[model samples]
Structures are given as structure tokens and as C-alpha cells.
Target: MLNTPVTIIQPSDGWRSLDLRELWDRRELLYFFAWRDLKVRYKQTLFGVLWAVAGPLASMVVFTFVFDKMAGLPSDGLPGPIFYLSGLVIWRYFANALSAASNSLVGNQTILTKVYFPRLIIPLSSCITGFADFFVALGVMLVLMAYYGILPGIAMLLLPFLLLLTMASALGAGLFFASLNVKYRDVGYILPFLLQLWMFCTIIVPYSEVAQRGGAWRFVYGLNPMGGVVEAFRWCLLRGAMTGPGNANATWILLGTGVPVALFILAAGLLYFKRLEKMFADIV
Candidate 1:
């Protein structure tokens, strides 16, 4: 009897051919990775989980103090803290996730060289870790909502879609930056400056009503992706305010344009990452 040898196809030494379904098949591993990341983030910190809750909460407090009080910004006449925190939750998730994903490939160099899993999954798992923190923040939001004596509208039922939108936006950008950072270490250096600019771009510190009244700002504000997200949050939560108009058609327009832009950027980023992934282990 003769022994036969089996042949197999291996992933190219490149990142271009990222297979979503194949990654999905590795769903068990993905869950494990996500859970592991969550554990790592909170493992030895002094505040532990409060560190997660405090980030957005602290930012919200500062914004409410300065933007709403000193700057005299309006929150569509809703409680400034409530309004700003809602927007902050979405913006913080996206910014934090994008930053983490951008650095993931470099940080996990050991795993990349030793094992073979989808390279894209590394950054993707980073972003999902933020999603785990999102619910923790949501619990704080419930307390804030009660403190403000505001009732959420039927639109509150749409929270899932909004959450999905934030996830997609982060992951789309996450994939882009992750791939880019592998080739250019400069991507990491520039990320903070970029997010700082992104911070002012979104009405995170102050709500959109303050933005709309600044005359020229209203139009320029439309350029930010989170504009629509913030508006929807207000509509869902702040409809009872004296000047509150809830959401606007403009937000719908941003949502419409943003979804495609995010997908386009993600696809292009994936392709670029795949092209450069071949060189990561060697140069990194």
C-alpha cells in the first residue's frame, strides 16, 4: 500500500483576501478574543470598571460645566448634562474604538507572527470590546434619565439601530486605521490629533442647538458623521424640552450619506490592509 499526501491552501502572506464568512466560522474564537480583551481592560485597574464609566461621564461633566454654562450653549432646552452625555456616549465609543483598533495590529505582533487567524479580526475584536463597555454606560444613562425627569419616546425602541450605527462607524474606520498603521507608524501619532479635531466636529461637549445658532456652524456641522447620531439621541430622549425639536431631516440625510461612506471606507481599508499585511511581520 502507498501512502498519499494531502495538500492545503494557506492564507497568502498578504491581508487582501479577508474572508468575512471564514471569520464568522471562527465565531467561537472571536467571542473568546472579545471576552479576553474585556477582561484585560479591567483586570488590574484601581477603579476597574469605573474607569470605563468615568471616561465618558467625566467628559460629559466638563462639557456640561463649560460648554453649557460658560459658553451658554443650549441643549435644545433639555438638561445640558443629559443631552451632552447622550451624544458623548456615541462619540466616545467611536473615538475610543477607532484609536484602539488602529494600534491593535502593532500591539499584538506576537500573536500575528505565531498564529494564523484573520488579521482583521484583531482590530475588530478591539472595537467590540468598546461595545461591551457601552452597556455599562447605558446603565449610567438610565440613572441620568431618571434624575432629569425625562421620559424616552417610542423612538427609544430604536436604540438598537443607533447602537449598530455607532458600531459600524467605528469598525469601518477601525479597519481603515488598523490597516494603515501597519505600514505607517505615523498613523498612531496622528490619531489623537485627528480625534481632537473629531471631538470639536461632533457636538459632544455641547448639543446641536448651540451649533445651529452659530449661523455658519450649522452648515459646517453637517459634515460630521455623529451629527445625525446626536440628533437622534435628542429626539429619542429630549422631546419634552421647551425648545426641543427632537430629530431633523438633516440628520436623516447625514445617516443616509454616512452609512455608505463608512462602508466604502471600510471596504477600501480592508483591501489596503490585505495588500500591506504581507509585510507586517517582517517590518513590524
Candidate 2:
């Protein structure tokens, strides 16, 4: 009689033992998760994908009026609509990805309890659904850039890296929250309020405004990963035309400072998630 083969399953030994090979082999599962999320996002919505475009458009109008007209905030020299829209494009992607990823494991508790795949796939895949909305909103940003005669230069090539940075920052932060949320549940309530404060600290206001306050505030501003990303977005799309000469170096400084901080967050989040990954099946 031929012996039937049996496989053994075990938890990974260390934080560094992420099993990248397994993750790569199971890449198709990631695609399915992302597709399911994309479909579900618009499942019953009347506007469907147009909600992606509408959201940024509506925000641009309000931000332009409130910040530009009422408060007289500086947009470097860029027009108010385009300025706000650029930041909005990046901010919206990060916000949506973070929100979804934080809830991903809990929301899929049935699958968490029943099946096995790279648990990392759940949070990683959750970040991808927002890219659809991101691209849709980006089209609107392009139109605004054309209207304002802002021709992107060689710097535009860096847009992909900027987006990758945004994704990294979101995934890193989301991983930490996703793991905590499985146990705490308060993350669901706290995340919305947290994002509101986070947005205010990003390029919602010119980084120059924050710099004026002094070194201490500038240091805090530099620590926010999204702040550098938003400024970098404007630099890439507007060719440094978004800020006056004085503020141009400030954008570079923020970018310089934010990259390392973002990487640190990714590493820290990964470590925390791995530490708790074993408990997810039992507790969740």
C-alpha cells in the first residue's frame, strides 16, 4: 500500500523569517484579495467608480475656499485648486489604505479562523484596493495641472517612488494597527479621529508654515512620513513650482528626513505584527 503524504504547518521562528518565498508563490492569492476588495468597495454604490473622482473634486473646492480664500494659506505659488488637489491625491490614498488595512483581519475573521495563507497577505492586499481610487483621482489631478499650465519635468519620473513610499508608510502603520485591532477593537473608533489629525499635519498646510514656528515644530513635521510624500508629490508634478525659492530646500529636507522614518516604521510594524501573528487565530 502506498503511503499518503501529510504536510506539517508551523509558525515562523523569528521576525526576519517572513517566508518571502511563500509570499511570492502565493502572489495570486494577493491578487484575488485585492480584486475582491475593489469589487466590494463599489458593490452597492450608485456612482460606482465616479466616487473616486468626485471625492477629490469636492475636497479641492472646499480646501481652496477654506484655506485659500478664507484663511489665506500659502500654496507656495501654485493655484489653490491644483495645490490642494495634489496633496489630496496622496493623502486620500494613504487614508483609505490605512483605514481598510487596520480592519482587514477583523473583517475577515471567518477566513482567519478557517483557512491558512500568509497572514501578511491580508493587510498587504488591503492596501492595494485604494490604488484604483488613487489612479482615478490622479486623472483629475492631471486635468487640473493642464488647466494651470504646470508641465511636469524630469522630476515626474520620481512619482512612482513617491507612491511606493506612500504605500510603505501606510502598510507599516496599518500593520501595527491591524494587529492591535484584533484584540482591542477600540482602533476602529480611534482610527478615524487619528486620520483627521494626521491629515492636518501633512501637506494640508504648507510645510513652510510649520517651519516658521521654530526648530521643534519643524522636527515634528519632518517625522510625519506623509508630510514629505505630499511635498514630494507637488515637487514631482509641479516641478518645484509649488513652492517659492525659499521653501524649495525645505521640501528636500522633509523628503530626506521622512525616508528613514518611514523605513523605521515599516520595520517596527513588521516586528510587532510578527510577534502577535501567532495569537491571531486563537484570539481573533
Candidate 3:
């Protein structure tokens, strides 16, 4: 009789020992997970994908009425609708991505116990699923821009970089919170309130407002990561129309501060997630 070979698997040790090759090998599973999330999100919903456009659209209307009409807030010299929608679209994507990714491990607890795959895939897929909503909302923004006769300028070329920054920020924060959620469970409850506060702190109103305050205020706001992304989105998409407090100098300040902070969060989150990876199946 021929001898049979047995394969053994063991947990990795040390910070630098993470096997990213495994994640690359499991790319197919990642796609399936992302597709499953996209379908489950719209399943049985009456409006289907329209639900993606609705949230940002509704917020734009309220912001237009309350901030532009009532509070008399500035629109950065762009049309009120497009101005608010610009910020709303980016902010909504990050907020939704962060929320979904943070709960991914706990939400899919059964699968974690039954199988072995890159645990990072759960939160990463949730973030990727948010791109569906982002593109839908972006389409609505383009329509509004056309209606307003606002043309995108050469600055629009920076969109891909800005978008990468946004996704990185969401993934970083989500991984951190998702890991915590497995043990504390209260992370799920506190996340909504925290996101609400984060939105207000960011340039949901206008970068001009934050920039005008200047000094430590702008520096602190840039540390939020999303603040820079929102500003860059406006700089890219609304460059031809924006006339308020925005300027090239402000954009530089925002990017310089936000990019570094976002990179830090992403690195830290990955390290923390790897450290906790071995215990997720048991705790989750």
C-alpha cells in the first residue's frame, strides 16, 4: 500500500509574518463575497438599486432647505443642490462602508466558525459593496451638474486618487472597529452615533467654512481623513463652478494632512486585524 501525505496548518507568529499570498490566492472567494453582499443588500427591496440614490438625494434636499434656505449657509459659490450632493455622495459612501464593514464579522459569525479563509475578506467586501451605491450617487451628481451647467475641469483627473483615499479610510476604521466588535459587541451600537458626529466634523457643510476658520481648526479637521477626500472631490468635480473659500493652497493643506493620517490608520488596522485573526473564530 502507498503511504498517504497529510497537510498541516498552523497559526502564524510575529508582526511581519502575515501571509498576504493567501489573500491573493483566495481572490475568487473575495469576489463571491462582494457579489453576495451586493445582492443581499438590494434583495426584496421595492426600489432595488434606486435605494442607493435615495439616501443621498433625500439628504441633499434637506440640506438645501435647512442649510441653504433657512440657515443661509454658503454653497462655496456652486449651485446649492450640487454642492451639497457632492459632499453627501462621498460622505454617505464612507459612512455606509464603515458601518457595514464594522459589523461584518459579527453578522457572519456562523461562516467564521465553519470555514477558513482570509478573515480580512469580510470587511473588505463590505467596503467594496459600497462602491455600487457610490457610483449610483455619482450619476445623480453628474445629472445635477449638467442641469446647473457646471462642467468638470482638468482637476477631475485627481478623482481616482481621492477615491482611493476614501476607501482606505473606510477600510482602516472598519477593520479596527470590526475587531473590537467581536469581543465588546457594544461597538455596533456606538458606531452610528460616532459616524453622525464624524459627518458633522467633516466638510459636510463646506470646506470653505473650515478653511476660513484657519489656524488649528483646519489642521484638526484634516486629521479626519474624510475631510480631505470631500475637499478633493469638490476640487476635482466642481472646480469650474466653485468660487467660495476654496483655493489651491487649501487643497494642498487638506491632502498633505489627510493622506498621511489615512495611511497610518490603514497600516495600524491591518496589523491589529492580523494580531487578532487567530481568535476571531472562537470569539466571533
The numbered model that scores best in TM-score is 3
* Tens-digit lDDT track of model 3 for 95-188: 9999999999999999999998889989999999999999999999999999999899988889878878888989999999999999999998
Cα lDDT tens digits for candidate 1, 177-202: 87777778999889999988887767
- Cand. 1 Cα-lDDT: 0.74
Best by lDDT: 2
TM-score of 1: 0.87
Q: Which stretches of candidate 2 lie over 4 Å from their true place?
A: 1-16, 246-248
TM-score, predicted candidate 2 vs. hidden true structure? 0.93
TM-score of each: 0.87, 0.93, 0.94
Query: RMSD per prediction, one decimal?
Result: 3.4, 2.4, 2.4
Q: Where does candidate 3 stray beyond 4 Å?
A: 1-16
Q: Show the lowest summed lDDT stretch of 10 residues, model 2.
A: 239-248
Tell me which of candidates 1 and 2 scores higher on lDDT: 2
